[model samples]
Target: DADRNGFVMGEGAAVLVLEDLEHARARGADVYCEISGYATFGNAYHMTGLTKEGLEMARAIDTALDMAELDGSAIDYVNAHGSGTQQNDRHETAAVKRSLGAHAYATPMSSIKSMVGHSLGAIGSIELAACVLAMSHQVVPPTANYTTPDPECDL
Candidate 1:
């Protein structure tokens, strides 16, 4: 499993509803969790390649955490964008360790790309839905089929 290659392309669709806290409460709706924070940036270095330095992704993580007024220690889980490529795995690992620092070692991170295949535009929503379910159930999903440890992608 550690011997990575590429993601399995998939076709699917998912939808998630976003509701304000007060509005949901007013309607007696089930609130999953707060949206907290998110960040996005352009990796202009390459069209399809990412830097092993992971500076871009790390900065995005830092910005999101800052916006949420939370630190890496507050994170309970990480839904990694694990694309199964060697570069993606190492890059993601590096970014997480940089942004999360010591907490990265404690946080549980996984990717459902193997299970659901990489659904491209739909994968993000699907994964976000998984996060909400995980929060509701108080469970974190594991990286599927992982047997050997690739020290490069540790944590």
Candidate 2:
């Protein structure tokens, strides 16, 4: 687990169709889920690297939770932006813990990038698709290829 280096430049694409809940119901469309909250942030800490403390990511998470009208305890799972780098993993763990408190430990968080590699533009859609599938099947995907857990990235 600690041997993480970097992600491969994978290639893929994904598409998600979002519509109003009322519109979906009126059209008799099967709605997978609704987006209750969303947030994004960046501190310009680095071009491609995140801050060591991951405060930026933590703030985003906390804000989204607040917008969703829920607390950390309401989270059943987490979709991480894990890039298979030491810094990314460690800081992400800290960020989740910071925003979610102890609930972060109990939550199932994983990065689809582990299995699909870093698809760059498409990885976001791919992982979101995975999350939808996870919810549909009521199963959590594992961080594939990982053996021993890293203490730093406890999530």
Candidate 3:
């Protein structure tokens, strides 16, 4: 049997099927929410350390919102790239707050990295999968090992 808490590196592959709104409608398929926008950014400041200022991340969020023609307040859920590392967690919190302002406190955010260890190259897709699961269940996954909350990083 696979140990649930044991730490072991593993590898796998997965695929997803996506259809445009018009295509799905024409096929009489039920829609599971639309993916309005997506954006990616690199932490060039440090290999492992994320910038505390979060300018790049904030810009990325803004670009995504603009592309989708939706304001930050319209985002019901934010699937954070929660890497569980100190810098990542703090920076992500700051980024969200900077982008969403007062709404950040009201919005639900989570990181699947707590349930599953960071999967380097596949992190983005894995995170998206967790987001879909959360949206479907209407439940946000808790941030595991969050015993002590950092005051500066409170969401």
Regarding TM-score, does 2 or 3 come out ahead? 2
lDDT (Cα, tens digit) per residue for candidate 2, span 1-155:
77888887888998999999999999999898888998998887787787768799899999998999999999999998889888888878889999999998899998888888898878888988889999999998878888877888887
The lDDT for every candidate, in the order shown, is 0.88, 0.87, 0.73
96-132, model 1: which lDDT tens digit per residue?
9999999999998988887888999999998899888
Model 1 alpha-carbon drift over 4 Å, by segment: none
Where does candidate 2 clash, by residue pair? none
Candidate 3 or 1, higher lDDT: 1
> Model 3, which residues run further than 4 Å from truth?
1-13
Preferred candidate (TM-score higher): 1 or 3: 1
The best candidate by lDDT is 1
For model 3, residues 1-155, the per-residue Cα lDDT tens digits are 11123222324444556888899999998776688886877766877666887777988998889889988899898887766556666677888998899999999876666667666777666667667777888888876666666676677
The TM-score, computed over Cα atoms with residue i paired to residue i, of candidate 3 is 0.83
Model 3 steric clash pairs: none
Ranked by lDDT, the better of candidates 2 and 3 is 2
